[model samples]
Target: MTLLWIITALWAVSFSLIGVYISGQVDDTIAVTTRMFLALLIFLPFWRPAPWRKSLRMMATGAVEIGLTYLFLYQSYHYLSVPELLLFTIFTPLYVSLFSDLLARRWPRQFWAPALLAVAGAAVIRWTDLSGDYWIGFAFIQAANACFAFGQVWYRQQSMGNPLPHRARFAWFFLGAFIIAGSAMLLTADWSKLPATPVQQGVLLWLGVVTSGLGYLGWSYGSTKVSAQQLAVMNNMLIPAGILVNVLFWGGHIEQWPRLLLGCACLAAALWLCRKRTPAPSRST
Candidate 1:
C-alpha cells in the first residue's frame, strides 16, 4: 500500500505537470488529439490490436469517456487553479461509487466509507477558498468522472468473454480513442497554428507516451499486488501530489497552508477507512 501510494502519487504529479505544460503550448483539442495519436503509435508495435466491432453503447462511452472527458478537463485547466481542480478531481471516487452501484445488480456497501472520505477530503481542501469559476470546472469534472466510471464498467463487461490480452486491450483502447479524438480534431481544429517551441513538442511527447501510456502500464503493474482499499487510498494522494508539483515547478497558486493541511487530514481519514476490514458476506441458510 505504501509503495502503491508513492508510485500513484508520482504518476498524478506527472500528469498534472503535463497538463500545465500542454495547456500553454497548443489548443486543448489539438493537445488531446496529438497525445492520442502518439499514444496509438507507441502502443501499435506492442500489441497491434484490431478495431472492435462497433456497438452503440461502446461508441457512446467512447465519446463521453474518451473524447468529451479530455475536452472538459483541458478546458478546466484554463479556467480553474490547480488546487481548485484537485478539489473536483477527488470526486472521482464518488462518481465511481454511484455508477458502480447502478451497474452492479447488487448494491454493494463496500464503497461508502472511501466515497465519504474522498468527498470530505475534497471539501476540506476547497470549502473556504472555492469560487464560482471553480464550480463550473467542478461540474465538468463530475461529468468526466461519471463517464470514466461507466467506461470502466463497459470495458470490463465487453472484455470478459473476448478477453483480448491486456497489452492488446490497452492498445485497442488507445487506438479507438485516437480515432474518435482525431475525427473531432478534423471537425474543429485550426491547423494553421502549430506549437512553435521545442519545449512544447517535448511536453506533448511526454504527455502522450509517458503520462498516458507508461502511466497506465505502471498503474496495472502496481495494482496487481495492491488490494482495492490500497488502490482507493493511493488515488486520494493525487490531490496533494498535484498541488505540490504545480506549486514548486509551475508557479501554481499556493496561498493557504491550513486548507492544504485540512485536505491532507481528510485524505488520511479516507485511507484509514479503506484499511478497515469489512466482514465477508454470509451465505444464505
Candidate 2:
C-alpha cells in the first residue's frame, strides 16, 4: 500500500511532464515505444529463465495494459481535451471493481461502495463542459480504461508458481509491451516529430526509466498486498494527485478549490472504508 501511494505520487508528476514536454511535440507511438524499450532494458539484467507459458502470460498482460492502453489513450487526445479525457477516466474504478470481482468468480458487495465513491470523487475533480466528437472520444477512452482495468486484475490473479522472483520475471512483461509498441511505432510513428530539444529527450528518459520502469514494477507488486476494493479506490487517487501536480508545477489553474477539497475528502473516506473491511485474499496469493 505504501508502495502504491509512492508510485501514485510519482506518476502524478508524470501526467504534467508528458503533457508539457512530450504530448504534442513527440510522436505518440514513438514516445510509447521508447518508454517500453527503456523499461524493458531496466529489467533485462534481472531476468531469469522462466516457463514459456508463464512468460507468455506476463507478456500478454503487458501488451494489453501498457501497449494497447497507451495506443488508445494517445489517440483519444486527437478528439478530446485533457479535461474531457480525465473526466472519462472516472469509469475506470467501476471497471476495476467489476473485472476483479469477475476474475475471482465472486462479488464482494462491499467493494462497490468505495469504488463508486472514488468515481464520484474523480468526477468532482475533473467535471467540466464537454465538446467535440463526444461519442468517438468516449469510446476510445473507455477502451483504454477497460484494457488497463483488465490487465491489473488479470495480473493480480495469475499464478505461475515459478521459482524466479517477480522482479526477474517482469522483463517478460516489458518485452511483451515492447513487441506491441515497437511494432506500432514502426508502422505509424512520424519520424518528423521526434524529440529535438534536450528538454524533450531528458523528459522522455525520466518517463521511461522512473515512470514506466519503476512505476509499473511498484504498482504490480503493490496490487498483490491490498484487497480488490482498495485497489479499485486507489485507481481514482490519481485524479486528485495529478490535479495537485499540475497546480503546483505546471502553472495550471484550479478554479474551484472547494470542490477539489471535497473530492479529496471523498477519496479519503472511501479509502478508510475499504481499509476497515476484511480483506479477501486472492487465490493466486
Candidate 3:
C-alpha cells in the first residue's frame, strides 16, 4: 500500500507530462516502445533463467497488463475524445472486482460494494457532458481497463504461493511488455515524429525510467500486500490525486469544488469500509 501511494503520487506528474509534452510531439507507438524497452533494461540484469515456467507466467502477466492495456489505450484516442477516454476509465475498479470474482468463481457482495463505490467516486470526479461520438472508443477503453484489472488480480493471486522475490525475476515481465509494444512500433510507428527536441527526449527518458519502470513494478508488488477490495479502492485514488496535482502545478480549475470533495469523501469511505482490524500481508513477496 505504501508502494501504491508512492507510485500514484509519481504518476500524477506523469499524466500531466504526457499531456503537455509527449502526446502530440512524438509518435505514440515509438513513445510506448521506448518506455517499455527502457523499463525492460532496468530489470533485465536480474532475470534468472532457472525458473523458466515462473518467468513465462510473469511475461504473460506483463503482456496482458501493461502491454495490451497501453496498446488499446493509445489506439482508443483515434476513435474517442479525451473526455470520453477519461470517463470510460472510471469503471476500471469495477472490472477489478468483477475479474477477481470471476477468477475465484465466487461473487461476494461485500467485495462488489466497495468496488462500485470506488467507481462512483471516480465517476463523480470525472463526470461531464458527453459528445455522443466515438462509442467505439468505449470498447477500447474497457478492454484496456479489463486487461489491467485482470492482471492485478492474477498477479496477486499467483504471487502468494511463489517463494521468489519479485525483483529477482521481474525482467521477464518487461521483456514480454517490450515484445508487445515493440512489435506495435515496428508495424505502425511514424519515424518522422520521433523526438525532435531535447525536452521531448528528456521526458521520454524520465517516463520510461522512473514512471513506467518503477511505477509498474511498485504497483504490481504492492497489490500483493492488500486485499482485492483494497486494490479496487486504490485503483481510483489516482483521480483525485491527479486532479489535485493539476490544480496545484498546472493551474487547473475545479468546475465544482463540492462535487470533487464529495467524490473524494466517497473514495475515502470506500477505502475505510474495506479496511481490516488486524492487517495481514497476503504473503511476503
Which number leads on TM-score? 2
lDDT of each: 0.62, 0.78, 0.74
lDDT of 2 by residue, 68-138 (tens): 98888877776665544665665676667667656767554686787678667756754664344655776
TM-score (C-alpha, index-matched) for candidate 3: 0.79
Q: List the pairs of residues colliding in candidate 1.
A: none
RMSD of model 2 against the true structure: 4.2
Summarize candidate 1's per-residue lDDT along 92-210 as a digit string, tens digits: 55544444445554445566777677667766766876677766776677676666545644554554455455565566667667777778788887676466778888877887787
TM-score of model number 2: 0.81
What is the alpha-carbon lDDT of model 3 when measured against the actual structure?
Answer: 0.74
Q: Give residue 131's lDDT in candidate 3 (0 to 100).
A: 34
lDDT of 3 by residue, 1-285 (tens): 888999989977876677667776788888888888888899877877747787788888888898898878776766553433554565677667667766776543565566678657756754673233444666687799899998888888778777767775468778888998889999989999998899999999999899988888899888887887778778877766766666678775566777767776775666555443213223221
Order of candidate numbers by TM-score, starting with the best:
2, 3, 1
RMSD of each: 4.9, 4.2, 4.7
In candidate 3, stretches whose alpha carbon ends up further than 4 angstroms from where it belongs are 76-88, 107-129, 132-137, 253-285
Give candidate 2 misplaced runs (Cα > 4 Å). Answer: 107-129, 254-285
Q: Note the residue pairs that clash in candidate 2.
A: none
